[model samples]
Target chain A: MQQLPREESLRLLGSVPLGRLVFTQNALPAIRPVNHVLDGENIVVRLNDGATLTSIAPPAGEAGLVVAYEADAIDPHTRLGWSVIVTGYARLVADPSQVARYEELLRPWVAQTMNGVLRIQPDLVTGFRLVAQPAVAVCAAGGEGR
Target chain B: MQQLPREESLRLLGSVPLGRLVFTQNALPAIRPVNHVLDGENIVVRLNDGATLTSIAPPAGEAGLVVAYEADAIDPHTRLGWSVIVTGYARLVADPSQVARYEELLRPWVAQTMNGVLRIQPDLVTGFRLVAQPAVAVCAAGGEGR
Candidate 1:
């Protein structure tokens, strides 16, 4: 199994058309897929229509927010896999001009109402890898082989 | 098109096999998914592997740690969706005896590791939806469209 470097990982995330965004609510964790674009060290996303808009819209103030972006090719050949996760806090784009700029660059896959532009202001970004490794032998607990 | 009621949305989240956990890291947002179990009003999650484990492992003195979680589903045909978001503190399960009790209920579909267990202690939980409404009008300022 080969490990993906941090730079490559960022590149994959920036370029990917679709990635999963994970957030927390109450005590459980949640994840949703959305279109993302990389700007400098930040990531821009647009939530067109769904529950996401409600949370980011009015009522929900500037409190704790977490957004994760993930993308990977689990299997290119013989279909195996790998998955990387990026977790961070995200804020809604207040400036219409900035929102419009990103809207032009990144388009939403979903076509419907409740559509609005939101940005994830990432704080602590951590990543991981899942590469298939060759089978290695492990000693049986009792050493009893039939 | 159909909308998922608050109760049903939560149930759907509980039923899913995997979900991404999003939270803030040093003011920046972060996200990762861990195997979780739904315990009625509160959602119990176990984080003992990969990005999630490394990020939110609570310190000894800390009893409550803030975090957020989200999950949803999209139907292509209907263009309708529903989601639930939970915000709360996540703490590590310390009691050696009780730890086993929580771990027993958690089931991992793919990767499972045993470094430590994390439980998201909910502070606030809410939900929302994105319903599709008919367009009032369409204006075509192009050459081909009539």
Candidate 2:
């Protein structure tokens, strides 16, 4: 696997609109696939106010919660692709103007009412790609495996 | 969204060969997509010996680390599907027979060598489905603001 640079990793992240958000819920980890938009370096996502995440969110005016966001573009057929991970702090976007702006830009995948907007400020970004090995290629083409 | 029963949840989990495993590294959350198989109620997975997960594995003959495993089958076009989450303890499978059995059943997507087998003993299983709402269906068929 090849490690992607920070800039490249962010670029790959922005290129995809779908990703998974991993956070802690009651001391256990939870993951949810969400639609997101890039706001400079921050990731903006719409969360349903009555959703599990909103219910589990830390109180307002508190320090942001640490979370991890992951996106991948692996081909289901070949299972070869790149995956990017972002570890950062997440908090509700309380600024009305910013929230309004994101509301017009990002659309929730589900039909539920989304009354909460959260932003993630990344501290670490990492990515890796799976490259097919030469030996595997040769063997797949009837070389040494034969 | 409709809540799925435990039996249906496990069935959906077993139906998928790929899922993300969420764990903690340095007090921060980490996620990785891995191939797995079902051993009754236990979720079995293979990790490369030199992989990051293996490096963080607790010492052999100890209680497994608590982790979360999530899998979903969401349709990209409709953005509707079922998601299953299993919170459990992850430990290296020291039993050679169990390791060998999993090796024959599950194949790693990458060409890297897999020398460790880990089993997750689920403590809690949760799953839900995103159902198409009537408003969404009507709006999609030219109802709202038309």
Question: Which candidate achieves the best lDDT against the true structure?
Answer: 2
Could you give candidate 2's per-residue lDDT for residues A24-63 as a string of tens digits? 7777677777878888899878886436766655534767
lDDT for each residue of candidate 1 in A18-69, tens digit (9 for 90 to 100): 5676654433455556667888767777775546555743322466365566
Off by over 4 Å in 1: A1-3, A14-33, A38-42, A47-82, A85-101, A109-129, A132-146, B1-5, B49-63, B75-80, B108-112, B121-123, B129-146
Clashing pairs in 2: none
Clash totals in order: 29, 0
Fnat, 2 decimals, each candidate: 0.24, 0.52
Q: Specify the poorest-scoring 10-residue window by lDDT in model 1 chain A.
A: A136-145
User: RMSD per prediction, one decimal?
Assistant: 7.6, 3.3
For model 2, what is the error of residue B50's alpha carbon versus the real structure, in angstroms, after optimal superposition? 5.2
Native contacts retained by model 1, as a fraction? 0.24
Which lDDT values do the candidates have, in the order given? Answer: 0.56, 0.79
Where is model 2 more than 4 Å wrong at Cα?
Answer: A49-62, A135-146, B49-61, B137-146
Global lDDT of model 1: 0.56
lDDT string for model 1 (B63-142, tens) is 56666766555443343465566666777777877678776665432333555666665565555564654331111111
